[model samples]
Target: MERHATSAELKARAKGQLLGKYGTIIPAILIVEIIMFAITSVITLPLDTQTMPGLIISFIIECLLQLFAGIFIAGQTYLYLNISCGGNIRVSDVFYGFTHHPDKAILIQLYQLLLMLASFVPLFLLLALWMVIDSLYMLIPITIAFCFGLVASVIISLMYSQSYFVMLDFPDFSAVQCLRFSRKIMKGSKARRFYLDVSFIPLYLLGFLTCCIGLLFVIPYMNTTYSNFYLELMSKRNGGNVQ
Candidate 1:
């Protein structure tokens, strides 16, 4: 039998998980992410110029930075998920997540980077054609492109949502297998996942409203909460305890 959780139950689980682990891990994760972003910005700065060469260089540098950041973020999520299970949460757990499963973590990161690039190709081509056409006729293809692009984005989100956990918990599984497993878990549960995504909208808005300072709290809160939600869902499906 398939198992399910209501939005309220998920939210409660998230809250409990966040409160339980916030003091031990959130600060470390935030610091690591901030440092990674800063380093990425510094490495890619020269590539952001207006020239063609600069643009090309910037694109390449940006892609590399995203790959690096994805690894760090995915590793952090893995550590957090393990903690959400039975393991003790520690600052070092984040580092261990990378060291212990370096290859899988990097592969997962690469997969994410590729998906991001793939998602933009169509939109990029559509816009390029629009610039060339520069007319009402361009709107037709652009609109169609936009709809397909939106659907693709959602599908990608659903497919890869649980990838970090898969990499962490099921190290033997390949990236494609992990992605397929995530999609299967999400199947017949689109409405719940959509609601979960929607629930984060207010947090994002709050962050925006606060000049992004709110993110310091909101990001950790959301990450921890979502980790718990993922654990609960998996536990129910496998008929196992959360620990």
Candidate 2:
């Protein structure tokens, strides 16, 4: 009978791991943010979203950027997982995904994105039908469908939350296999994961109050906590062995 750590316990562990390392972690996370921001700014600086074609092009560019950003995300996962496991910290670790299997990293992100978009298809169809009908009577069904779609999207997101982490841990696993393994491990833990996520709301709110500067600290804390959560899950799944 393996015992799951409470969110408090996990956060405490993350705090312990981060105790003297904030100097390294904070700058590492900041460098990643700066690079991402610079990339987005440079790429979108030329786009004019005033026209229909421009809007469509802008949307496509945004989606492509997001897919590309998935590689950086995998790199972030690699960095944090390293921190959680007492490995050396490097700001350059942020490019781990790019140097590793970037194609598979992008594929994993693309699959998750497609699945999330699919979850919203029903709602989109209902909204289109409502627009065509323009009847107050159609509102009820549309609202119900919207709620269902929202729930499905949330669940799907949670189900695949660990996909990036899985990819980093099992370099040989296919993107689909990583997604499947993530869904498998998340079987009964979605609600727990949800609760852990919700618990961070206050810190985020407090961070926002500091003119957004506080997030420089909060973000790493949250990432490390999540890293700890992933390791905890893996440990339990592996009969008390983390790796």
Candidate 3:
């Protein structure tokens, strides 16, 4: 029988998992992500003198590199989390996440990207309209963009709150099915998820304030906790049984 955990219990169990199994890998993941970011920055540097064609080429190359790196890093992180939690993982397990479930992972990534991009479209359009209507009022676009971006970010996070879990736990599920399952699992709990996300805001700000060193701890904590949360949910759905 599945064991249903209250949110508080879920959070506590996740914390325990983080402390026990995945704590050591936190620093390594941070180093890897930082190295990736650095490489991306170096490759995307603007030339001192930017001709239009040169600038365009550089921009495209930079964007492509960034996209590739982002996907690879994210996939690797998921793999690492799964393995670290005792799933018999390896270094190459990162690539395996995508390779093993190419369609579903790709779809998830694409959907996430589209949602992010779509969220900005309206703000951008409003900004353009504002520019045309009142060029002197540049603040309008800035404010609107900031507000819309904030709201959109929250929505996107909620929508994909269970994406990693879906990827790990429901490999047999199609992309659309995984998305739908995430929605169903999170149903009637958008506000609760939002609140959970909000609770992390302070840690995020603290990491920023500390020049990201704090992420060495925060990232691992969040990932492991999230994995544990997934386990808890799965256990509940599967009749209080966890493997």
Candidate 4:
């Protein structure tokens, strides 16, 4: 494995790649997102979400949307990384996941969503118990339990953070297999990943400061930085033989 990129390097590389291309990348991303959202709504149409049938339908639709989202996310990630590494690129590169193994893209997302939900069981149980408890003082401990559950869920998430990209790298892998591989590769990078995530706070605030419009630029930069970090880590995992 080679030396991993510093946070600064990853972000700077993201910005550099997008320097003259924000117009294309941003609109392409937005188009993908809008289509995904519309399809999601269509799939779960006209259901009153307050009802049980509605809830179940919503859950199924949510899972399905995960599939669409995974494809777009992976596609965009490929585009950004390709351009950053000096490949000739096009906006339609955003559809690579779908044009390739769309099923795998969707399945990985469904699997990960289930895994994420499973991680929240403790939180759900605590909240349910908290709702039934009699005394006000008991609420304090319940609150603490909820907080603990939340922190645990976040840790669980970081463990699987790289799974989708791993799917891209190893298309033959089953969803569970990619998750296991992600956990293996991410062993010592959790804290560093956390720091990388934290370093985006100011950029997020700056976007917010611009009345949400600044997000047109900030979000794309954020996505590319994330892609760079993943590529850097992947390269290190492959002993500097990043393909």
In terms of lDDT, the best-performing candidate is: 2
Summarize candidate 1's per-residue lDDT along 6-40 as a digit string, tens digits. 77776676566666666766677677877887887
Tens digit of per-residue lDDT, candidate 4, span 1-243: 546788889888998887888767777777886897688767777878999788988887787677678888778767776766767777898999878777777776777677667766766676667678766786676677677767766777778778767877787898788888888878998887889878888878988999867778887787778777778887886777777
Q: Name the runs in model 2 displaced over 4 angstroms.
A: 48-50
Model 1, residue 175: distance off in Å is 2.2
**Candidate 4 positional error at 11, Å:** 1.3
Better lDDT candidate (1, 4): 4
Candidate number with the higher lDDT (2 or 4): 2
Clashing pairs in 2: none
What's the lDDT of the predicted structure labeled candidate 3?
0.65
Give all TM-scores, in the order shown.
0.86, 0.93, 0.73, 0.84
Off by over 4 Å in 4: 1-3, 40-45, 49-60
Each candidate structure's count of clashing pairs: 0, 0, 5, 0
> Looking at model 3, which ten-residue stretch has the lowest summed lDDT?
19-28
- Candidate lDDT values, in order: 0.72, 0.89, 0.65, 0.77
- Candidate 4 global lDDT: 0.77
How many Å off is the CA of 36 in candidate 3?
2.5
Candidate closer to the true structure by lDDT (higher is better), 2 or 3: 2
Model 3 Cα lDDT, one tens digit per residue, 1-243: 433455566566556655544434654575567767788668766554268687767866655554555446446657545743666544455555446665566677667666777888877777768768886677766787878887887787787777756766667788777777877776655776666666677888999899987877677666665666566655666676764
